[model samples]
Target: MESKALLNENSDLVLISGMCVAEVLTMQGVFTFSSMLPFFFEEWALDSIEAGWISGIYYGAYMISVMILVSLTDWLDAKKIYLAGALVTLFSCLGFATLVDGFWSAIIFRTLGGIGLAGTYMPGLKALSDRLSGKVRARATSFYTSSFGIGSALSFLIGGLIREWLPWQSAFWISASCALVAFIIVWKLLGNYPNTTGLRSGLRSLDFRPVLKNPKAMGWIACYTTHNYELFAFRSWIVAFLAFALTGSLGNLEIQPSTIVFIGVLLGMPSSVIGNELAMRYGRKLVVVSIMVLSAGFSVAVGSSVGLAAPLIIGLVLAYGCFVTGDSAAITT
Candidate 1:
């Protein structure tokens, strides 16, 4: 019986790993679309404003979903919620792959994808949190969030390669495949872990008055918002910055923008782990605040330099990766 119990425990860990991979793939599907926007706009004859809307609409949808779904996480089976989110992502990818022919079409599909993302990201975190404890929980959350970076990096690199060899639609098709795989894995591997943390009782009573009134929760929410704004702005603009900086320095060669972004992303992979370890050894507040301040300072320096544009841009990438992701590990804790 003990041996059987150990085997079950190992299987549970494997399931968690699958959940992590699926969540990452779905995230990659949403984020990689940004890297392909330049090519997409030209192919579909979309204006810059329209392209911006395509991306912005998704985020808007994501924001709304988070506001609604995060509150419901405690009431729902997290695995089921995750599975539903993955299915939505798969449907969104299918729409993007087949139905997107114009600006409005792209916007609609992307927004759908965003809704799926909203459920996947936070709920996935909650799911992992339920299954882990203490230092292990901290480490798992770090890995889970870092998977976002990994997924984004892979999306850019793989999308670029597909665009080189085939049509841009191939990228969407690949994303669809990933989403389907995620759905399958999540369905098979993840068991229903109900939230027993009194969140349900509180939510059912509609007594968020206490949670909202809590200063510590409010403070963390504030920090998360600020951090997200900075992180999103940098992510959305980094490829453009890299392109401009490279053009100025390298004279508009046929170098891939995605490749450059991938390089910076690769450099950032260790950041979350390092940050988590630091938080464990030192303190979460100290580590998080210090990294945020460092990121702000580096952003200023990078924005000021013109002649040394490429190096400055690279420095900014490294700083953003190090600081933004460094603090990210603490947010879940």
Candidate 2:
């Protein structure tokens, strides 16, 4: 019986691996675009504002999609929704790789990709969460969320290496491949999660009027929105800030924006696990709130320019990485 239990646990791990792969692939698509943007803008003769708009459009579309799809998760078969997301993402990548010729075209393709991501990420979480017992669910969620940080880091590293050797288009091709691999892995490895269909129908039957009455859920949403705002703002601007800050002085250095981004991501890797462990040992709310306060302080330190600006920035970045990830796993839980 003990051996059988261990085997079942191992099987669960294998199933969860598909979720990890899907997240990594999806994040690779998003992060690689950011890394490749400098080259893409140069090739297309677009200005920074235009490039920023293009990035903004993708994220905006994704945010809208998440708002719509998150509610639908109760009504939809999570596997089916997740599969649809994978297909949408796959096509979006193909569109970017083959059809996007200019700024507007790229924006369109990226927005589509974001829509696909909307279907993939949250639904994937819902599906995985439903499979575990309440006692172990938080632990499982942490593992899943940590995969995103790892994926983002790998995407930066890989995107930098790819750009070093080939054109920006090659990065899209690589992203597409990663997505395809994830699609295949999830299709084969994961079994249908039970009770999702009834849950979906019940959600569909409701008016969605009473759902917002729950102050707890609303507070959670507020926390999520605030976290996303801070995170996206930091990530979107960090590369540009590095370029400005490191210029002239770092002319002899082999610093790429992607490399710096990867370093920050690398620093973040342990944060998720550590945070989750702390949450398990202490309480999730206590751990998350404390980390958020620390992260906010680091954000301010990084934003300030004083005596030891460079070192201060690096120290703040490390701190930010550590605390930013602290809440991620808990959010899903």
Q: Best candidate per TM-score, number? A: 2
RMSD of each: 2.7, 2.3
- 1-333 in candidate 2: lDDT tens per residue? 999999978877776776877788877777776766667667889888988887777778889988777667677657777888888888888888788899889888989888988888888887777776765667778878888788778777777788889766777788888888877877776687655458647566355566588888788778878777777666666666665665555545577877878888768867787887887889978888888888898888777743345555556666776677778877667
> Where does candidate 2 stray beyond 4 Å?
195-200, 203-206, 306-312
- Model 1, position 257: C-alpha lDDT score: 72
Error of 2 at 179 (Å): 0.6
TM-score between candidate 2 and the true structure? 0.91
- As a whole number from 0 to 100, the lDDT of residue 25 in candidate 2 is 82
What residue pairs clash in candidate 2, if any at all?
74-200, 75-200
Error of 1 at 323 (Å): 2.2
lDDT against the true structure, per candidate, is: 0.76, 0.76
Candidate 1 deviant stretches above 4 angstroms: 1-12, 195-207, 251-254, 309-312
Tell me how far the alpha carbon of residue 227 in candidate 2 is from the true structure, in angstroms, after superposition: 1.0
